[model samples]
Target chain A: MENHERSIRLPDNGNKVKAMQQKLLGVAVIAIIFVAWFIAARIISKPLVLPDFVETMQQFFKGWVDSRTMSNLGITLKRVLTGSAYAVLVGTVIGLLMGYSTKVMMAVSPIVNSIRQIPIMAWVPLSIIWFGLGEGPTVFLIFMSAVFPLIINTVSGVTGIDPNYINAARSMGAGTVAIYRDVIIPGTLPSFLTGLRLAVGSGWMSVICAEFIATSKGFGFLMIEAQERMQTSKLYALMIMSAIVGFVIDQLIRLLEKRLTSWRFKNGKAVG
Target chain B: MARLSVDGVTKVFEEKGKEPHVVLENLRFDIEEGQFISLLGPSGCGKTTLLTMMGGFQAPTSGKILLDGVPVEGPSSERGYVFQNYALFPWMTVEKNVAYGMKFSSMSAKEKQEKLKRLIEIAHLQGHEKKYPIQLSGGMQQRAAVARALAGQPKVLLLDEPLGAVDFQMRELMQNELEHMVREAKITVVMVTHDVSESVFLSDRVIVLSSNKGRVVADVPIDLPRPRDRSSEEFDKYVFKLTNLVRRAFQERTDTTF
Candidate 1:
């Protein structure tokens, strides 16, 4: 019996050790990627095509303190925030309507699905014609890119709510408005948060594409300028900066999701 | 007048291009005020459909359900329901969930608070008030559901397999808690369950339904005293009889289909 007990204990310790090993393996993968990039850069031996890893690293550190880089980052952040905020608000309202009423869903889903199928770049010409150049067109593109994902996810979220919750609310004398406020809204929150995350990620990418093609004043434009002047290392640095900012924003949103939907993560197991 | 009455209740499911299927046909029963009744049957016997209809979650196809001589038009606080899965709002704390049913009630602030406190005490969920439903055990979640249902001071309580989710040991404990809570509240109850032993132990009367068309099969009164002994021969006899009835009903359904 004692030996059997000891054998059962072994796997519990093994699981912890296995988890630690996985973390180390992730770090090792990052190290290997950096080493491979350095080696490939040496073989190419052309800074214009692929700058040396050390040179790019130096430029990357320098870009952090560069006022020009900082301003471009701020511009991009503003556009993403503005577009995504509007998307979240409108998406939630329409999604709730669609989920609650089959008539609205039947009417709206066809148009929404067709519009979403069109690629973001395909709308650039139309956006420019409607809004002119600079911030207007770029922001419009971002909005168009972000809103559809939010709408789709929000609709699914609302439709996915357990019918029991609605019945329970009704049994407690909750009317249509009260049910929307108490049962439908809170129930759809987890899915809405997921939609927000996806929306932001896509919005960030759309803003860059929009700036590259239609605007003169954001991070994407800055990258284009660096490329034209053959400042290869600086261009690499700008790309890295864009990636780091996107990573940070994604992380913050994830943190916000954790904070807002704390109920989902309680008890060390997700209940709903 | 009866506290609740089902007048020729029938339910039909109509699917596109398919025949209209009758799940329950002319189910008629009356529940007296402050009596504990259980709707017992095999699976797919429409016991839950009957319970949902009683709670006004669904309307019958061709008949009406009346509560105190008034037909149930829709769901209202007068008929509180407890679901099998204990549908407590995951976002809210236990106290908030319990207070939810009374949000629009006419009770004054003080009375509501006092009732809330008493309910928490009754459900034995004092320390767990601030915890979310996801953080609770199966039994505690069920208790929280009952507390929420009772918060409205409902005239009748409708339960749909209230103990179905709990483990065997926990089921017995929750059954006792449920009986105690119902007695204290003095509310009429209509519980739907497939467990014969459970119905015999907690109900004043058990109305068994046949599986094929959800027709009434048996109406047996327990006639036993309070805090009934589950291990007693009398209790076992009731269990055995109901179990056989439920089994035969299920067999009839299978035999016809095959």
Candidate 2:
């Protein structure tokens, strides 16, 4: 009887072990891929084209340790922050105006529609002509790329707010400013954060492209210079660095989004 | 003073290319201070429309809504409205949601906290002060909504089917809580409800309304003692009479040709 009871409990323990094993299997697969790539690099005749993982990692560390590379990365981040700030400010204001008034919505909708159709890449030539080279053109491109999505999303956010909330506030004797501040702003924050995430991704793409074409600093410039000099290894290194930076920024935004939306998932997950 | 008086209130809703629909026609009523009055009717009876007009969220096409003998031209801090959907701001914590209208008041933070504590206690939401609306159950959210409206200390409180969305057991419980809150606060309450038993259980007087050109048809008074027993013979008699009145109103409307 005791043996039978142990047999029954064994399946539950087995399932727990199975779940842990699956996680370990995932890590093992990633490790295998890296090992395979490293072995292939040694076997290949054109070793420069497919540099060993060890060399690439060393270069990555070197780039990080060098003050010049760090400063260039810092400059790129600064541009993104400044461009995103301006975009969020202008976009949110315009969105609020359009959302609240039917007349303004009708008048401005066509203009926003036309502007939205123009690709971020297509604006590079005009941005360069308008603002010239250096940080200005690159930042302008990033701003132009980010602002439309932010505005559209913000307008949608404002429109999606429950009319009952507005009615409740109004009946409570809240003035216009109070309603907008207390009800409208908090109501739209989730959608606004979503827009902010999308803007960051788009802004990064535009800024990199602008940098590749015109600027002297940043990862994009370094990648282009490496390509011109036929340094594939350096080019790949810069590409990897850019990927890391993009991923880090995306993760940071996701963390913020989770924090903001935690109120909705009170029982499901612990708030970060 | 009479808490509110609607003088020949009429409301017409205009639709493009269609004839205007008259919701309320020469409907007049008065609510005395500290009285619990319920506007009971079928759906589309314009009871909610009348409530909104009284709250100053909308204006009657032709008529006047007076509060405390003063003509109500627009919404003021004196009137508090509770929505059927329990329109508590989802982003705010329960305490902050209750504190929302108080932000506009010149009361200091300490005074606001004291008032918030009182309202929370009255609504039986003492422990869930930090929770968001989404975290609370439907009954809890409604209770928090009640706390929010009472926080402003308005002259009159309007409830638009406050218990409509709750389950039957919770609805009964909420009915008792609502009645207790009204009695304790001594605030004028004008609630709209479709449930006949709920009206009888809570109201001092129930106003029955007819729909489709919605007008007040019957003004029934419930003289039962406080803490009404639903299973009692007197309660059964009142329920039967109110049911007959509603049935007659429906049949009368159906008999009319388009």
Candidate 3:
């Protein structure tokens, strides 16, 4: 009986050990990279060009405590949230419409394709011309940057749904609206979440660019001001901050995606 | 009383730049109320097409299908269909999938709950109500699909190879469960299947159809007693007879084409 229990428990114990070892290796690698970067920064000449790691860390901490810096961060975050919300709402509606009907999809395909081809930087010129140098243009640029990815992913997700699912719904006496609500929306959720993640990343890039180009406030403007003054330490600090924030946001989105697709992975075996 | 009637029903599929392909021709059958009828044939024999026509998912090219003397234009709640793929909604829990059909009905929440409870019990899914379709095994998913179809209390239940996706062991168990459900519900059933033993096991009568311009060639009544034994001499004899008929149907199609 003891041997039987040991046999049953061995695989689970082995798996747990393997998972912990992998996580430890990942952390060790990251720590090594950080130490190497610090050492290299110390040896580099001209602090203005490449500030020492200690100085950069000090500046980052100061920026965190600074009221003006905190307010600027808040402003940047607000613009990103608002613009992304609008893009998601509008893009999802259009995507659902296009996904359901071939005619609508065809009609909108060319326009979406052309829009996607143009860079978000290119939109800055047009946005400034249309809405002038203010928050409006900044928000508009962010919205434009995020919408195409959101739309495309939503449409692809909705269209990729299995025909059997829809047929099953129909046989169960579901009306068009019920089918859309109960089947189409839920079926496309994983893809929609993926699109939202892409949109968030794109929206962040656009908002920062817009703030640097046209706005008087926000982290992007602070970075530009630091660049003009040749405050390399402050600049490095801000860059690090942005990188950390983006990484955190992406990780959060990934966590959400994993939660949503848990059902897909629950079988514990890979399917072809 | 007949629950569904297929009178001279024929189906022809036409493409943009090709000759029309005839699927079914002059297919005539009547499903009496509460009767279990199986449409047994090989692939591409138009059994699925005929089943779809009965369910109102498709219309006959030349003839008509009637449900209680009224013509079927499109899908209606009166005839519930169970797909071979066990098309359970992946997003919804088993209970929610069962309740999906009743969303449009005027039944109160409590009444819907009561009905759903009964259905869960009937489908033998008493404990796994909160699990999604993807969480369950193949047999369980098919059971959930059956529960979802039966939720609306449809007059006629249409099954298109409903047990095809399961393994042999599970298939046997589901076949028995299905027969029990049919008898208990007393609802008219019309199933299309490629499995001869499955048809003989669950059906009151099995309608064998010929391929390539499909038409009913035989309507054999299954005189075997219920709760059928697959290994019994009688069951083997029937299986042999049906297999011969199916082989002959294919042979006849080939001979006519040449």
Candidate 4:
């Protein structure tokens, strides 16, 4: 009993120490990158070409207090969220149709595949023409980038569903709607969530690109304005902020994935 | 009237620009109420296909399956099927999985609660109600599956190599549990398996199928008492006889293929 207790107790303590070491290592890596940036900036001796890390960090902190920066950040957030929501809704429907019926898949796949082949940047001109400037073109570009991953992932998810689950549900007297609710939807959810994550990442990327070309606001606009004015420190600050936001968004989706599919992670491994 | 009857069922697979393949030919069997029947055969003998047809998952190319004199059309709650994989919904907890079919059952809330409680008890899953299927071991998953199928209180339960996925050590314990569960439920069961000893142990009648075209080669009855000793002379004799028959069927399949 004493040996067993020590064996169990040791791992818990070991895990805590391991986690602490990982966190410290992460902090050390960031510190090293900042130091490298500082040294590189001094050696380059050109503020326009490479801003000092300390000055850029100051700019980053100042931007947090600036209302214009915050408002622009909010706008970018709203555009990306709106575009992603629409993509998820529309893509899921099309995906379900494609997955359920061979006729629909055959009809839609060729067109979808062809369109998906075109880069998100290539769509900007068409989007601007179709929707005009400002939020319209920007949101459209985000949607275009995001929807393909969602659609493709949802289709694979549906197609890859175990037939046994469907059969089991059917044998349990589940009708069409019940089968969807209990079997198909839950069965396809992990893949769908994975698709959503990829979609959102791509959507975030295209939104900034769209803003750079088509919009007068957002982080893209702020960065462009800083660059044109040779505010190298501010430009670097905006880039860092954008990256942090993107990281946070991805983390939020992972949290949501965990929340929605708690059953999959109950034993620290994906079941089924 | 039989609880379930397969009347001259034949399954043929037709592919475009290819000769039709015969999976099972002129197969006929009747399962009486409360009798444990096993369709024993080698792999590729269409036993799984036969079981699937019996559960109304697919249609036979010719003839029909009658359940209580009514034609089996499609999957219904009246016939519960336990797949080899123990296909419990990964998203639902063991309790919810067991209680799933009860939603469509005519049993009242009180009756369902009682039935669910008893099933969990018999399946030996009392403490793990809230746990998901993936959290359970192979034996536990199989037990939960059995509970889920029995929850519907179906007229007959069909199994497709139910213990095939479980580890060798757990198989015996599961078999004993299965026997007890069946005894308690007193429901008719039709199981498909390749294990000769398993068929002899669990089945009232073992319908041996030839590997070539899945024809019934022998229909042997097990006269052993409940919880029979596996090492007993009588048990070994039955296992030995059935093993030989299955081996011969396997040889015939190989000879025909070459």
* Winning candidate number (lDDT): 4
Model 2 residue-pair collision total:
0
lDDT of 2 by residue, A122-210 (tens): 88888878888888888888889889888988899899999989988886768889889978887888888889989988898788888
Winner by DockQ: 4
* DockQ of all predictions against the true structure, Cα-based: 0.55, 0.46, 0.45, 0.58
Error of 1 at B114 (Å): 1.4
Separate clash counts for every candidate: 0, 0, 0, 0
Over B136-224, each residue of candidate 1 has an lDDT whose tens digit, in order, gives 77878988999999999899999999999788988998999999889988899999998899999899999999888898888999988
Scoring model 3 with DockQ, what do you get? Answer: 0.45
Q: lDDT (0-100) at residue A257 of candidate 2? A: 85
The sequence of per-residue lDDT tens digits that candidate 4 reaches over residues A86-191 is 9999999999889878999999999999999998999999999999989999899889989999999999998988899999999999999998888888888999
Q: What is the lDDT of residue A79 in candidate 1?
A: 94
Could you tell me which 10 consecutive residues in candidate 4 chain B have the lowest summed lDDT? B134-143
**Quick one: ranking by TM-score, best first?**
4, 1, 3, 2
| Cα displacement (Å) at residue A272, model 2 | 14
TM-score of chain A of each: 0.90, 0.84, 0.88, 0.91
Off by over 4 Å in 1: A1-24, A268-272, B251-258
> Residue-wise lDDT of candidate 3 within A166-243, one digit each (tens)?
877887778899899988998898899899999989888888888889878998999999999999999999988888
The whole-model lDDT of each prediction reads 0.89, 0.85, 0.85, 0.90
Error of 1 at A11 (Å): 11
Candidate 4 wrong stretches, greater than 4 Å: A1-27, A266-272, B254-258
